[model samples]
Target: MKPRTSMVILFLLPASLFYLALFLVPAAWAFYYSAFDWSGFSDTMTFVGAGNFIRLLTEDPVFWRSFGNTLKIIFVGGFFTFSLAFLLAVLLNSGIKGKKVFRALIFMPNVIATIALTTLWAFAIYSPRSGILPNFFKLIGWEAGTKFLWMSPEHVFWSMLIAIVWINVGYFVVLILAGMDGIPLEFYEAAQLGRLSIHYGVWKTPAHLPVGLRHCHWRDDAPADCCSQYRCAPPDEARIPAILGENP
Candidate 1:
């Protein structure tokens, strides 16, 4: 081989092997199991020949609901997540006092353990009778969405979505805040002094999703693919499977 070709091969070989082992091989195994009649670690493996796909399409209602819920998560969830993240980023970047403390407060939720988070939300906030949400609404006398059974079968999907959005907001807040930090302070200063719309330029962050989601989903890489389709996930990354309430 030419020296240039040899050098290229040397550089590409490790990445190629890694892709084959981690990505390609696992994908091939998934495909193999898709056609099987095996019950997860059973000794016997029967070839079912497209039975899984057929059953999912024809017989499964929950799968379709989960699929629809996934779609809701992608579009609705993504829209709200990005909007809230940008809104907070803009507010924080607007020369606010004690911004460091505010930033830490926003990002702290993403650092907490997912089990603790779910428990807190379930027991403290969504406890139906004496939850913080109901008490807060009662204090304000709004009485909207506070009376519903948040963890019920009917409301669980939206409850899960809201919880996911709330926890994941901090991750995107940190991400978009980092993106905003790159903007020249002069723009924000001018906006403060002369009152301009330069802040909009800082919020244009469609390109940041891949990097943000990849870093956020590093350990929990499975949702990286699924959520990348929707365009977001929490920073802790462990809450997704549990949030979806899926089982083996």
Candidate 2:
């Protein structure tokens, strides 16, 4: 039997109110404030209906550049991150030995403080003199590669994109893996009985079902993904299976 409308509303009401209180209301206030010109510290607000937006669009090269970077992170970085996560999640789920240990190792970067990761990337990985990449290039007799400055303006954005992808891929991998784990083992057994490759079934079947599509359901989680590149998981998020409970 279908749930009654009242029952549906009763279950959703608490979350709906929370969303309005925390997100929608604040967003509405921001949209309202966008119509005015006010130094956030000033007592006076000057009404400049759409003028601020006009200035942002026409008079701001820096704003446009930053906006472009945001788009790049969303599209370019997201593609690499999710693609790698899907491939790794599939491989990791293929009855690999020590899978739990591998998962923990992959997830280590996410749990670490972001500043520490940045420092490691800047000094140990990208540094021109003694960094890993430079030295590897040197060892390979690639002088031009050894001298390349990864932090330079020409390369910094891509470097940051790579770091963002590296830090966040593990979390998504774990998420996809969890979804795969939810699939009935009998499904795989049935596939095997039909002389079908289990790996193909795992990848192909889930892609059409809720398991694969779950990651695409909420793009608003972008804040969590983007900020995670620079911050440790929040306290509640650090609770292992508790965080996983949302997806489950």
lDDT of 2 by residue, 48-111 (tens): 9999999999999999999999999999999999999999998999999999998988888999
> What digit string (tens of lDDT, one per residue) describes model 1 on residues 71-101?
9999999999989999998899877999989
**Model-by-model lDDT, in order?**
0.73, 0.76
TM-score of each: 0.63, 0.65
Tell me model 1's lDDT, rounded to 2 decimals. 0.73
lDDT of 2: 0.76
Off by over 4 Å in 1: 1-27, 138-146, 188-248
